[model samples]
Target: MVGLNRLSLIATLGAVSAQFQKPLLSQLDDVLLETDKTGDKPLVDTESLQAHISTESLFEHANALYELAKSSEQEFGHPTRVIGSEGHRRTLEYVAAKIDSLGDYYKSSTQAFPAVMGQVFQSRLVLGHSVPESASPMSLTPPTTGKEPVYGNLVLVDNEGCGASDYPDKLKGEIAFIKRGTCPFGTKSDFAGRAGAIAAVVFNSNPDGLSGTLGTPTPYHVPTFGLSGKDAEPIVEKLKAGEVVDSIAFIDSVVNTINTTNIIAQTVEGDQENCVMLGAHSDSVGEGPGINDDGSGSLTLLEVATHLTKFSVKNCVRFAWWAGEEEGLLGSDYYVASLPEEENKKIRLFMDYDMMGSPNFAYQVYNATNVANPTGSEQLRNLYVDWYESKGLNYTFIPFDGRSDYDAFIRNGIPGGGIATGAEGIKTEEEEAMFGGKAGDWYDPCYHQLCDDVGNVNATAWLVNTQLVAHSVATFAASFEGFPERETTKAAGVYEKDTLYHGRYLVR
Candidate 1:
């Protein structure tokens, strides 16, 4: 199949005609000849794939993907490719078409899963007689507007309403005013719900305007809203002054369950039982185009996948672009959960590429080999370290807390490793010394904002990371001699680890 060119097909036809003693080619009504139009492109393998990857090719593909995102925005009216949106659907289609084009080299497959489309909420929190203001609803916030507002005596709870014990008995039938920190939103909501609270308000401890997803959906909580600590401080002071602090929370939201896709493809060669998987989130946050956030990651995978068609691999190299990573790794979680235990065992490693092209970048690798310390993670760690060392480039390890799509893979005990440039986190002076960028600036100043469009991309970071990704793909595709293989699983369910759902912040 590697050498199945047009001339070879013609030669095959001649042989068939000679064997049958008839001119089968002449009798055929429709043309049946297919060709390896790749011409002299090297057959796909570690060395060949590495050799074929060029900056120009990767940049061209990146530009096209950015254009696709812009086109989706122009057509869909949403700035982002959030799951189930026009941008996202079109993005998947674009990637799928590219994968299909490589049908000659790989066996493409998709794992369809149900996703809860993000909710539409018209919510307000009316404190006392003040007119209601737009309350930042937690991500995956449930709808609750039953013709009557939720009325309760709002009482104060400790900072980081992290545990049930934090809610006093007075919270029964009252609204719990908790501060956000230390725990997932679900934990706070669950504690408040169990304490008989009718609603929960989680105000941020930081001055930064508070608003984010509830991590994931939960059934044990009432309607919850997040507030900026700056806005809520006055209320906390009022309550501390022995005020009653009456409040009403109203939430009207419509939820939809949508069918989304995960794009997957693997080389036709190599052992099926052992696979090296590279993944990136194809969807973006609701905030903006997210070109640098993940457009960089997805396009990197696309360019690598495209070049992979040039040569054959020794071990199967599988490429995946997940749909809903911004919504707390939904696509990856579903894909990993749906796999049978036997099939799950087939994955040797999962390496993620996300936000690798942050404008103010740091070459960060997931610290899976250390803190998370899953099996065989060190090999992946060394791959990046050695590569960076050879280039005299600085690289550091970010905690592998499953803040991205790798959450699902590591939960199932797959040895997970990956790289990220940076996100909303500020880059410090120490980092500046190593990576040589300005100190005290956001790694991606436009992390999830409207400006995260094509113009926001860091071309140098994108090119460097894409090449490294290609090298990893090629290295793993060639052999797993030093990589760790997965251990047998005892049970198959929603695999849970202590991985932080969104950030490295732990919740217990």
Candidate 2:
């Protein structure tokens, strides 16, 4: 019986040697055998055990964790702000509790929510006739209230044919009908506002489409709304008939006090000096529950932290679940900007996981152009590619587009990279053939919308990507070489272009 047990151990050791060349696994085997001889369970050698854990097994575990997170999202429903009127604090508490259950490796930090909200603009439009359906409130525009709906006749103000001052006085108490051309929308709107016009409806002149915001937040005293080109032609025709048209307008809605929080957790070990940072946002837009939008990435980070705690990595790994990402990357930007110089410099590399689990999703790599460029680092990009290829997984290089949390890191000149599943944009026929997704469809239809629930994700794709991230993380943490220190610069230059791609400057 003893000989058989010894033989089994020998086979396991031999397999480890044949599979991996790293010395850590051999050290782990010695510890395991010593425990067997002493009639006690031996301490697992983290480095060595990591080598033996097959990629398939790691992916399986990662998939299980993804499903678990998805279930939690369903059970918890949408997590809005807790302390704020939105009720998202419960979600923060729930996330903290989950990290706590994983034991002592996680720590939580409570940050004060900053005050930032959509700006409210007052828009008033008087028309020649009652066209209620033709005029609905824009999505981000606030509603208005007043003593009376400001009424006026629709006057077609052609800014080019007529002078800029040829409005309002000609049709006071009547709508100013304007052709959409020549001037900026905001400029036309401002001109109309000064002329005492109740509202200005700008229609598209071209066939393609005219969709844009009214520049920055403008405080127009009168309510304003954009009219689609198709909807405005008939109204303009009627006004041109020299008919008197009167319409009322008001926009008095408050867009204030939306709140969000950032969730941070640190590992248990205090002695680990070097650090690896992993992050993903936890909040979605007011659209869907964002299960796949970011829940996939967030959960993957959680599972990686959970498994890594079981194995002792030499460096400290910080896991961040950021909030207000959909609100224009507010949370991450705040956190990075707040980090002290020393701590910021210690962040060797930032691995951002935004949307990693889209089914039929394209695999992309960031920071891959011009390996010799000073703005980006080829070393980190090559490290990621090598790790993925070693595991026999497919991946593609994607240029940094300033679309995710990595933007904050790159702005600070830190080496940043991440994986993303496609979103909003269509995958071309060629891309579809290579990636096996339907062409002419968005990578994610529910992006920033209310339909981004659990059903929106491809479970199989999510599983594979999550596992790939885990493997990449483990490899980078274990064996990445360090870069020489460079002097920091204070100029507001493009960090990604100069430092990330060219390896030139660091933001001070």
Candidate 3:
């Protein structure tokens, strides 16, 4: 809406009206030509582009997405845009419609890929003759649907079951009992399966109820479930006393490969060889509307892209709405892996925006200080730092721990950085002092819950982060200037191979 009038004016006065006698939207080339002749603003300026960003515009998109999810719940079975659900399909259509309304200022396309998605229908865990206090199935775990409930003596694994030696010969034909720590639930499940265990159960390190993922589906993984530490304590005490503990673990689930699409758009006018890419996952976890977990990030990109159509750029700007990020960054991974080398080289930098409106917020910028970071990542980080300093805003750095959609970009030796408010991480006193939120509360108490609806977003945090998004995007779209070149040497962190992100939960 910001540049609609200007575009109409161009269509009315330009060749479309005078020569062809049509009301066609003026192309970027014509706009540039007109700018050159009239000595008007040509390349996109940061201030004007950013001025289009407003809390009203950002939340408008957010509310639309929320309403879409809520309305699709009866058909989809949940108020979610999860990868395979009808809600997700509608979400993609919404994005496509928005891009189409931009006329010909940009070229938009979509990529489809087959991805594995799992759903658990039922999970039950019983110790001895009674059930535990709480039992939740680990995501993507094998289900014991047709088979009898797994019946075996409990085999308490040694030392959290992170290594091969942790499971002894006694684990054979038994249920592995392990503690969660030092490794992923998948690793423990894998170890249990390799040790010939019938199934696996991992208790949380804390006293809270456990909800976890086994990373991705694997042949070596066994049916796994997470239990509260409080319930596991009594069982651990009985096992230590050499008391025989009989158990039954059952999970009814389905794992299927489904086709999903990722929306991609790029400005038709700019240096295609040095493109600046920005992305956010479009799909949410299967719990809620995800209005803040990533709806904030998605709408921020949408709002920015909407306003971006009003101007021209020197370097091409690309926007991606990735699908299936909740299932271990599947959409983004498929995208990066499918790119040809020449096309991949065209990307100058990739900026990821995942969560931007945490209820209890703190300004966070990715610090590409990990082994996977390429040469230019530090410069990108510095750009964000400089911007925050210029605005007199307090900010913090988060490690590139192979989380979020940036993992694929950084893994391929492309420099990347972006902003987030926060997620399940707790706010410290220092952050509270700067951001003015409760010191000990989770950044987003509604993270991955049914309550994460339109009301969960912190409007001030969302607006500020969106402003940063506009600034960085507009700046890069204009010129790369001193940005770093892509490095050919591939770097892989030691932990990168095993680390899987399930809504900020490390699933390694």
Question: lDDT of each model, Cα atoms only?
Answer: 0.75, 0.58, 0.83
- Candidate 1 clashing pairs, residues 3+ apart or interchain: 43-310, 43-311, 44-310, 44-311, 44-312, 139-213, 139-214
Greater-TM-score candidate between 2 and 3: 3
- For model 2, the superposed segments whose C-alpha errors exceed 4 Å read 1-87, 118-141, 145-253, 268-273, 367-378, 391-393, 397-399, 482-508
Error of 3 at 381 (Å): 1.5
Model 3 Cα lDDT, one tens digit per residue, 421-478: 8888889999999989999999999998888888999999898888888888899998
Measured by TM-score, how close is model 1 to the native structure? 0.81
CA displacement after TM-score superposition, residue 383 of candidate 1 (Å) = 1.1
Q: What's the lDDT of the predicted structure labeled candidate 1?
A: 0.75
Top-lDDT candidate index: 3
User: TM-score of model 2 relative to the true fold?
Assistant: 0.65
Q: Which residues of candidate 1, in runs, are more than 4 Å off?
A: 1-47, 70-78, 119-135, 143-151, 157-173, 179-183, 191-196, 203-212, 215-220, 227-242, 248-253, 490-499, 503-508
What TM-score, computed on C-alpha atoms, does each candidate reach? 0.81, 0.65, 0.85
Task: Point to the candidate with the largest TM-score.
Answer: 3
**Candidate 2 structure quality by residue, lDDT tens digits, 1-508:** 2234544656666655555634655665566564533224222233333444343543453344334344334433543221232324455665677788887655667555673444334444445444544453333333443523555556788653134565647755445666656444555655666676666555666433343333323555234566666777767677678765666666654445455678887755522445668788766544345666676677677666666655545456678887766545667878878887777766666778887756557766675442422233565677667766876766777667656777777677566677777776677787786678888888777665545655667766666666666665665455444543322522224453432111100110
Collision count for each candidate, in order? 7, 46, 1
